[model samples]
Target: MNTVDEAPRTRRGGRGSRRELRSAIDTTMLPALKRKLPLVEPMDAAQIEQIDRASMDILEDVGVIFRDPQAIADWKSVGADVRDDDRVHLDRGLVRELIKSIPESFTYHARNPANNLPFGNDYSIFVPMTGAPYLRDLEDRRRGPTLDDLASFHKLSHMLPAIHSSAHHIVEPMDHVVAHRHLRITYSSMKHSDKTFMGMTTSPKNAEDVMDMCAILFGDEFMETHAVVTGNCNGNSPLVWDETMLGALRAFCRRNQPILCSPFVLGGANTPASTAASVAQLNAEALSALAYTQVVRKGCPAIYGHYLSTVSMRSGAPMAGTPEISLMNFMIGQMARYYGVPWRTSNTLGGAKTFDAQAGYESASTMMAVLMAGANYVWHSAGWNEAGMHCSMAKFVVDAEQCAMGYRMAEGVKWGDFNEALAAVRDIGPGGHYLGHPHTQANFQEAFFMPELFDNNSIEQWIADGSQEITERALKHVNRLLASYEEPKLDDAVDEALCDYIARREREIPAVDALNNEH
Candidate 1:
């Protein structure tokens, strides 16, 4: 709640004596990523406006379906043409006016004040992938994830230098009951990590429970003004905003917490086959959701969001890391900037079932597009595989390491000690190597991002080191991380209060087996 306590990214070490490089595998993840790369804007003003105008048309003429009666009423109250309790046509004037209340940027408060994240304008927060029904375990077994697996991810997310938020429901904890899984999920996130996290939006009650838990963890008075948590609301494609998502949106917006107004688009299936057409619809949907957030509580933070993946025409399956997706990301980024709101995008995603070369290439492509497109909140930044069907344990660690690598690139070129470096070059002869030079010694540790999972050693050295592949090495790092994990600071009374709250909620909610009807 206290802005004064905002933590800056810990400065890189100077002398080699007390130096510590940020490594995802080393479990020293406190300082968060602050992106510095220039945004990639491929579309010009005219092109961007074309999409914008198309989106406005979609909003004004085509209209978006709002399944929630409260949402429909809210729209009608705001001068929208409400044809019925289920559909509303929003005017561009009203949409823009309502959108004006959204701030350009805001702070996402973390339990550990030191880990607080700058949410909107300038920074990008990398988060782990969510909603993985199955997980490829450490022993290479593909199975549904359990509560312990969920806790393992939180621990890894806490320790991974590049991961910013614990990200609620990293994987569906199938071991826990449907009606009550949220309590365990939320508790695990708070217990395993002190970072900022997303709240469960499975049901309105679950959303309220996340807020209540947050109130217990962070004080009730503190939560009144500070945005400590976030929730994601996905719009059904073809311009439909169902009650399942609207309820969660209202719950988070009422508390003044941020929500991702994302449209879940499966191109050519739920949405138009044309990339530009789909984007226009996606944009209109996002704008309507953002506008409604203002209607719920004016000035509440809302992110311009979308989950982009083109459906394969031949196979009818979703594809990731495609050029079309990247192009759409660039266009979407430009659109969000024009609207003066933050945006989110997917990252480190692949269709590969195993953590192989295909996964690496696909993830790399996605990461490049995400950073260049200037996404402020990058979800599914790690461990996403098979187009979100499963989260691999090896891939999770490897993906976190890859995020660390991307973090370095997104930081862009540094020129802090440029003159000294050139002087060092002048001091050494052209033929002479600089490896032993004082300049190299002074800056080598922080000079480059050295990934622990990657093998940069020679063939003989690699063979001598047991010739382990990346997946094998990643699994080893995962085990090492869990073994070395330490619980972050949480007050004793607060912990007890959270425990008491969860125990009581378990008794209050009815027991259910499957995670059906996330309403």
Candidate 2:
């Protein structure tokens, strides 16, 4: 343990110490949005105008199904075309006016009193992924996560490092009534996290309930920073919106929370059964959602979230966390930039069965795309497995290291004269190793990356050392991080207050009796 503790402590250099290496990276080119990857070009100014016109036409002609009576009344009172059944048609002119009124960027306050992070150009956040395929029980057995399992998962997530924000309702399998409880547990557990994601479900009442929770956290001032409770509004391909979710979206937007337009158009599911159509559907939905969001609040911190996957027809379930998904994430990121908005994507790195090569490959591939695409945020960055069905705390540490490396990669390389050494190459001529050079001694630590799991040795040396595999190395790293972990420091009074808030809410929420007697 002491030896491992000493490993990361060897380099005590300050920031900008590796400027030489950073210079080596191409400043103009973003590798994450390379040309080989499909870049969804944004519509030209005229095309965008046309799409807006056409979308308004669709809204007015086809109209959207709105079951929420209040929402229908609000629209109708505002001069929208409302049908007898509550299908409301919004005018293009009104939408344009709404889009024009929204602001482009905003800040989200972290629960950490020490930090208040900004979300928009040049800044990004990474959140842990939730809902793994298998739940590791105290008895050491692994199974699907029950509602109770989510409590443990949420608590652990609040403890992990580098998880700045989060998605809501990580685990399901409870009645709709339990959904708010799940949200409460997440909020209480994520007292350390700066931002929280909202899962609106299919209930408008739930939407209002989510807003109440946000108000509790941020006070009435939450309306300004309330963009904290970002809601993901996904679409069904080329032009379909889930009416149940749309109402929730409108509610969230009205509250001024950030909106993450997540469009998960699986190939063959809600799409033309082709990857191109899948991408097109994702692209179109993102555009429509953004346009709508802007219409609601002109510049309301919006992120185009692309979570596209291929469908396994035989299984009839979405094939999530696939390589193509990551590939598409990279492409979508470029497209997001085209629209002048930040992008958030997910990478499912670990799984329930084991944190083996399969986990490593899938996680690394997706994460590479995230880093390469220069995404604004990468959620589910670590500890996700079996397609977000399980989470491993050990894997969480391993993935944090991976994310750290990704940051290093994003930081780019260092470049300078003198072969990256102050001494001349001629002074330290060819074939004369620079390891002994003073410049090498001074700068080598800054240039080199000490990987937690990668082995840098000859085969004979490796065999002589331990004959351990990467999975074993990663597992060891996980256990070591857990053993050596120190809880993040917080003001005692603040912690107590937040905990009290959670306890009070927990007490007030009605249980079985309330459920049975509900009107």
Candidate 3:
């Protein structure tokens, strides 16, 4: 094991006086831990190969429908069988060859270099929740999320060490106009957090707007050379690709930005009911879209995204953190390894209406599954509730603690010389304690996982302290972080440019109500 001194220091300054002091302290005190892949595969070689062969057959025989004419034409150019009706059949050999060009791993650049995330391999990147319409907390009430709520989530994510990326639309800002809400949410993510972030994928225009904003922050030329942004493209399952998602995919791919080619499938609803069959269909959809990224630009950075879950057949409600989902996460990780591409999945997902026992168990099970599966990009790492319909601030804090625990789990156990621990054990023989031993004193802080919100007080002490529940304690932490948040500084010119772009684009886009009417 490398000494702590060998670990790199993360720079956190350059904004203001307070931030400078905070950054200096953070860099000197806290060293980033390098994560390792120590996962055991759920599927053996034959099972994985079977899934691959089945997926290939689905692509070649059933074929995939590309609703966009350009997509069909692009496939045709590559000698793919593009029927007049927009169904394109891919050659297995061609796909295998094209996918070989994709790099196994790449660095996702962040404005703050210290926050840069490594994709692929053993490294696991955690991102906040995306695309929720409602906000909830310990009060157990749900309401439309506002711009303020969105900013708070961003700040919370920024403050947490476990959350690596401030994902786009952590929650939909319903108060903002639909046509221009992305501008506000993206701006908040950029201004409030210096970490890696995702971009809008609602349409080609939205994607372009996000890129333009990124260019302002990172310079036009830098955007071309570095992947500073990522966007997600969802394939309309049952082997269909909608025009809007395809357009966004093209925009991101053309610029060499990473695109997460995901299939949003709910088993027994959009996909086959059987776990094996659902996985096969999910694999086909994800592979087709991933292959499309290569078709757009060979060697383009892409992630095979799996949003697989089962729906309750009786009530048709989406279920999360199920055994089926865990199996899918493991299977998808194997597939991604086979295809030589990074994969993305979610964590802390729960279908419970509140931050109760049900939510805790469900989220914990799902988080463990993703970590053990060795997911490269983890979204919804925190704050998801009500089956993805709501974002809870309390849950965010709770989940952040869980994520920190996951980091330790991913680090695995150190197998180096244990002389210090052994000596402590010897010194504190039978009927003795090691709490005050020299080695224990030296290593306890680093060896133990300390939770910020979980209560560990004695019963009497707890009563004296008002006996707060986990949710209540989490809210206190949330309030403290929000109160302490200092926006990361940006260059004066870049800040002005970003503001000007948002203003100009807001005027260019139709009003939200008007756009809704048109639709």
Candidate ranking (TM-score, best to worst) = 1, 3, 2
Better of 1 and 3 by lDDT: 1
Lowest lDDT sum, 10 consecutive residues, model 3, at 2-11
> Mind giving the per-residue lDDT tens digits that candidate 2 earns over 1-519?
233344234223433433433233221211121122333333455644444445456666766555456555556665777776666666666655554444445666655434455665556566667545455443334565555555544444443444555456555423335524544544534552344444444455566666666665556575765456666666655455666666767767777777677766666767676544455446655655665665455556667776656677898666655766665665566556645677778765543366667777777877777666667767777677666666665566568667766666666554753455655476777777777777777777667767656788999988876787665565555433333323344456655655565566556665544433432
TM-score of predicted model 1? 0.93
If ranked by lDDT, best first, what sequence of candidates would result?
1, 3, 2
The better candidate by TM-score, 2 or 3, is: 3
For each of the candidates, give the backbone clash count: 0, 33, 0
TM-score each candidate: 0.93, 0.73, 0.92
**Residue 6's lDDT in candidate 2:** 45
Residue 443's lDDT within candidate 3 is 79
Give the range of the ten consecutive residues with the poorest summed lDDT in model 2: 26-35
The residue-level lDDT of candidate 3 at 356 comes to 94
After superposition, candidate 1 runs with Cα above 4 Å error: 1-26, 514-519
- List model 3 lDDT by residue over 1-519, tens digit each: 222222222123234644544543221111133567567587889999999999999999999999998898888888998875799888889888878877788887888887877678777878888888888843546887788888888888888888887888998887777889889888998988888899999988999899889888887777766788889999888899899999999998888889999999888899988888888999989989988899999988889897877999889999988999998888889899999888899899989988999999999999999988888888899998888899988998889889888888788887553876887777788999888888877878887797768889899988878878888777766655554566788778888999999999999997848634532
lDDT of 1 by residue, 1-519 (tens): 111112111222333312332333355563556778788998889989999899999998988999988888888787889876677888899999999999888888998888888778778889899999989887767898889999999998998888888998888998778888999999999999989998999887899889899989887777768889879999898899899889989989988889999999888898888888888889999999999999999998889999999889999999988898998999899999999999999999899888888888989999999999989999998899988989998998888888888888888899999998999978897799999999999999899888788999999988988888887777766765665566896899998999999999999998855555442
Please report the candidate that would top TM-score against the real structure.
1
Q: Could you say which candidate leads in lDDT?
A: 1
